[model samples]
Target: MRKKIQIVRHVVQLIFFILLVLVVVGTVCSFQIGGFQFTEPLGAIQVLMGGSIFFTPEKLYILLATSAILVTVTVLIGRAWCAWACPVMTFNEFIEYIMKRLRYKPVAERGKKKIELGEVRFATLAGVVAAAGISKTPAWCNVCPIGAICRTRSSGLLVAGAEMLILGVVFSANMYEKRFFCKYLCPVGGLLILLGKISSLIIPRASEKCTGCKACEYICPEGIPLFRNPDMSKCTKCLVCYSNCPYGAVKIDVI
Candidate 1:
């Protein structure tokens, strides 16, 4: 079942990445299909912050409504969006594959962390909000990799150049540490991490007969020791531990 879930997740990721490409090519409109429009949580927050330091109640209410669906999902399933549908995550996996084929190793192995850099994502979130409020523009979106691909077509190559540079830096950093942006610097990820802390579904727990081996911890993209008092907020719900556990001690509890 775990292997099946992994296969299903890969398929979902591919489908979403294709949809993202369609948005880039003008084949599909972003955040909308037919009469139903949707807003990603970060985009909605930026809309509220970019206009004014003191936002109007109407604007707040409308953006809140538009962002509600995504927020609700985050609270239910943790960062399943990052694990299952993020275009960047698909790209990250592609990079991982290339690195593997090349036999390249990341600068640091997974479990050597001295500090939790994942918390830096919160600072990144604050920075994006501050940038919007100060510039009175959603300036971060101009360079955000997720939105940048879709924006480049309309914004022209000059603008796309800068966006790609940002994307390049983020992707290149993954060579130093896997999913570096997802772990440390993605504002959207930070927002989702915050929301996912309260997720009411898909909790992982270590079962009896589990040894103190750090296999699960070392394999986690976010470096969470899912087998040893895992921090669910930082968990992307990738289930690497559950799928790869040698002792079959990682039990996923759905509540």
Candidate 2:
């Protein structure tokens, strides 16, 4: 049952990533299909930070609405958006996949300190909000890789050059850290992590079924300790531990 859930999750993640590509391109080109629009649900942070460089004040309400919806969803479902549908997560996961294929996990993950860099994200979130408040600009948006991609089609190679340089740094960091940006530096993820603490959803565990093997701990991307009472706020809801457990020990349920 857990295996089926994991497989379905991967399929959904792939489809969502493809759709995100379309949205990024469609948003830039003003492309649309039969009354449907793709760029509407994303860029919540840039919008919250007083709009992106390309964003006009005319659509300021739309940006605020998107950020509100993101908050609402986080309250309802924890980090479900970050775990599955986020474009940044899609890119980070792709890098992690490549690294995993190179047999990176067995060496780097063992005995490594859990990467709980929430403080870094908090500091970044403070910077974005403060910088935006003072300058009336989405300061972080200037360096956002996905934002650069969205604007490059209309704005030109100047944006893409900066985007590529940032992407190189992010992807290279993932070679050692694994989901480096999402774990440490994503400002929006910091917001989600904060709100998700109050989220009622949780990954339930049946302690009776657990052995001391610690397989679940080894599999979690965020270094979440599955056998222990894991912190739901930090958990991406990736369910890797639940799916990998040889025993039917790690049951997922809501609180």
Candidate 3:
């Protein structure tokens, strides 16, 4: 079942990535289905923060309506966007695969001290919001890799070049760590983390049948200890532990 889930997730990621490219080419508007818009929640927040300096209520209502789907999805699935749908994650995986082929091990696999960047992520979120309000612009979006990809064909060469440079730097950082951007730097992911805390999504969790083997932690991309007091905030709902568990200790709580 876990194998099947992973397969489906990869397919979904690929589909979304393709749709994102289509969006870049002006083939589609927002992620819309059945006449409803699905947009990035962080984008809406940034717009609200930037425009609120002048008290833009019209934009507020429009943003709220557009962002509703994304916000609800985050609350239901705990960053499934990051793991299962985001084009950024798909591209990161490609980089990771190339790095592995070149024998560059990730920090987690190196037995080195992993730097905690959760605080940095939150600080970035605050900084970007502050910058947006003061500048009356969605400041971070200008440098955001996701935004970069979406605007690549639509924006000027210099603008797109700068955006891809930021994306390249972020992706290259993964040579030292798996998912460096998603784990530590994405303000969008930071916002989703808060929403994901209230997620009702049934995920692979350590059951009473678990031992103290710590196998799940060793395999977890985020290094969360499933049999221990794991930080669910960092969980991307990847379920790698569920598939790799030797004792079948990780099971989804259907209730």
lDDT of 1 by residue, 159-233 (tens): 668767876887898888777877788889899988998886987778896896988888778888765685788
In terms of lDDT, which candidate is stronger, 1 or 2? 1
lDDT at position 148, candidate 1: 63
How many residue pairs in model 1 have overlapping backbones? 0
- lDDT, residue 136, candidate 2: 69
Query: Residue-wise lDDT of candidate 2 within 16-47, one digit each (tens)?
Result: 65665554436421234565433323345444
Residue ranges of candidate 1 with Cα displaced over 4 Å: 23-30, 52-62, 110-118, 152-159
> After superposition, which runs of candidate 3 have C-alpha atoms over 4 Å from their true positions?
23-34, 52-59, 155-159
In candidate 3, the residue pairs with backbone N, CA or C atoms under 3 Å apart (3 or more residues apart, or in different chains) clash, namely none
lDDT of each: 0.77, 0.67, 0.75
Model 3: lowest-lDDT 10 consecutive positions: 22-31
For model 2, the run of ten residues with the poorest summed lDDT: 23-32
Question: Who wins the lDDT comparison?
Answer: 1
lDDT of 1: 0.77
lDDT of 3 at 154: 67
